[model samples]
Target: MLLPAASTVFFTQVFAGTPGGVSPEQAAATMVAMMAHGAVGAALGATVRLSFDRASGWLRQLRVTPVPQTSVVAVDVAVGMLLTLPPLVVVALTGRFLTGVRLAPGEWAGLVGVLWLGSAVFVALGLLLGWALEERAAGGAVGIVGTVLAALGGLWVPVELFPSGLRAVAHGLPSYWYAEAGHAAAAGRLPPAAAVAALTAFVPAFGALAAVVARRRSLPAVAG
Candidate 1:
């Protein structure tokens, strides 16, 4: 509900500045942001779901299984990634049909890459939040933080419309780069090689942080 509303509102605003309406590029970019935001929501929800199950002793009831804890996390990530695809396709197709948005082959490929990379980042961030906080706290925190970041990161609106200082701060977040990469792809412009490198770096950096947090929590507690 929020995703479609955000995309529609964004397109309407962008179109307001044009003679007729938004260009295909603007529409494509908005679609990419909408899809990516949906993926982020799935990833966050999956992480919280898994965390709740773990905290509730579901894992222990399975007995001493051969599956590693990390493998369990991997399964959660895979499930979240898979769950995101349908919504992405639905949003993309709907945007194209309703708004006459079109993407070239190269632009489409770039858009897909952005969605994958963006999903990876959000999944890692979700894992980190889940491992670092209690289940209830983690879910609430992720929901609130994700909503604000999505709004301020230009996923819900163009950053250019934001105040200068706020926009500058937004640029420091990973979401900003993800949105920028999508926009570049939608415009049929090749993103800088550096942007790809930065995204690659962020994946492992956050994933490792989440792994470390999860590992620490898995350890036996010391008597205070």
Candidate 2:
């Protein structure tokens, strides 16, 4: 989430003027990218933690309540959004003060919304990981998946920094779209509406998968 270390190399890279004549404005874009990545990464962690509860038979207990499984899922998705905010605040403040970044109020709000909404995509992924993997394995999965997604999606570095083929592949990931939405907000514009729309589309896609997995996970317990 872009922690501050006034003398550290990481700090220098982000706050120092961008190399190769990249402008401050351009460099500032990472603020949004970091926000999206940090939020989604944290959401993944939360999902893993919650999954342990499910694995331990916490969620299956709800089967008697007559709540549509989708409703339970909706709640998890909302919780993921809530989880994104606090870390986002820390990241925003750190990026602002540590880097001396400035943006309009609207821009700040836009980026926050973009990251918050985009997080649902990862949260849904967390659901799949949670249900699919063993409880202990899900813990490791969060780290592995976060690292891979970050590197491939421009969450760790700018997509422009990639070679052509890699960048093409990155474009296909939902993480890239999330980063794009955040970067566009940082640049004081709306991310492509299509990208935002696509993020919305993923909620249902990922959510449905999670729902299916979650149901399967519930089956043995219900049958008993």
Candidate 3:
């Protein structure tokens, strides 16, 4: 997470100081990328926790509960949300200190909200991967794949740097969408109402998918 955020801050400052100044829109875009990076980090942390639980047989014990299997995914998402703050603060401060990025007080609040919302999407995706794989080794594999995709998706580097074809593919990924929303909020181009709507739709959609995956995985296989 710091990797992506630091890269964004460094590049933004570098570009802003060059012949072409970094516009507010561009600065917001960089923030959005950094926020997505933080979200991915949160997801990775959750994956690690789930992997540990599986390896230690803790997940098997948790499975004995009367609570729905979806509860596992919910717990993971909750933990991910809790884990998001430190990295969020680091990225925000890095941008502010290094790039001298400033936002109105209201915009600052909005940016934080956007970051949380984006984190929800990544957390849900992590939960889905954990439930779908149902093994520690599989979870580790998925985590590695996720990290690579994040880099390819421009979470570490701006999509603007990608070739036109790869950039188009990257745009279809959730990280890109989250980054766009964050950029809009940070840049003040997104209205509060619109920002709320985007997050409202994204969080529930991903959450539901995670719940479904968890429930399906919990069911015992039937003999043919």
Candidate 4:
């Protein structure tokens, strides 16, 4: 949260006024994607923290309780989405009043909706990582994954500035589609159907990964 929020403030202030910037729209376009990307980091934080719970055998205790593990996961994802809101309000408010970037009501609707959908994609990813990685490794893994995705996915830098090859790679990442969707929404235009479809598809695909990990976690350990 600190990293993304701090970086967002720095990057937007520094880059929003680049010389001969091809598009003023692009210059002021950080808020939408930044909000969603921050949510991904928050989701990862929740997952990594829960990984410690699993390591400490708290999850084993949960098995005796009435709550389904899926319910726990759902709660975590919802909390992750909520975690995104404050940073977004802060960043958007700063962008508008401090940086002079603005969005219309409709554009705000699209940006926030698309951003949340994007966060949903990563919430699933975070769940999978939490279940799959050992507790000792989950924290480092979460940081690395979030940073790499944000850097390459154009959450920090616009995808347009990437070299052709790098741009191709960025397009293949879910983060790229997330950022692109936000960009489109902010411009008061819908993102391409393919981009929207890709983010939608990723949510289920990553959810399946988490489901697989959850099943394994529930299995009895084999004796040597």
Which has the greatest lDDT?
4
Residue 14, model 1: lDDT of 68
Residue 73 CA displacement from its true place in model 2, Å: 2.5
Candidate 4 off by > 4 Å: 16-23, 218-224
Please identify which of the two predictions, 1 or 2, would achieve the higher lDDT against the true structure: 2
lDDT of 2 by residue, 1-224 (tens): 44312222254364455556434574466666667767877888877665676666657777668888668766877777788787677777766776666888888888787788778888888878877777778888898998888889887677888999999989888889988888787788878887888788887898788767766664234333
lDDT (Cα, tens digit) per residue for candidate 1, span 15-47: 758788676657666777787677677777766
Pick out the ten consecutive residues of candidate 3 with the lowest summed lDDT: 215-224
Full-model lDDT for every candidate: 0.70, 0.74, 0.68, 0.74
What overall lDDT, based on C-alpha atoms, would model 4 receive against the true structure?
A: 0.74
Candidate 1: regions farther than 4 A off: 13-19, 61-63, 218-224
Query: Model 4 — TM-score against the truth?
Result: 0.87
TM-score per candidate: 0.83, 0.85, 0.75, 0.87
After TM-score superposition, the amount by which residue 136's alpha carbon in candidate 3 deviates from its true location, in angstroms, is: 4.7
Candidate 1: which pairs clash? none
lDDT of 2 at 204: 84
Error (Å) of candidate 3 at residue 88 is: 1.6
lDDT of 3 by residue, 56-123 (tens): 56676767878785676567767888787677777777777776778888777787776775677667
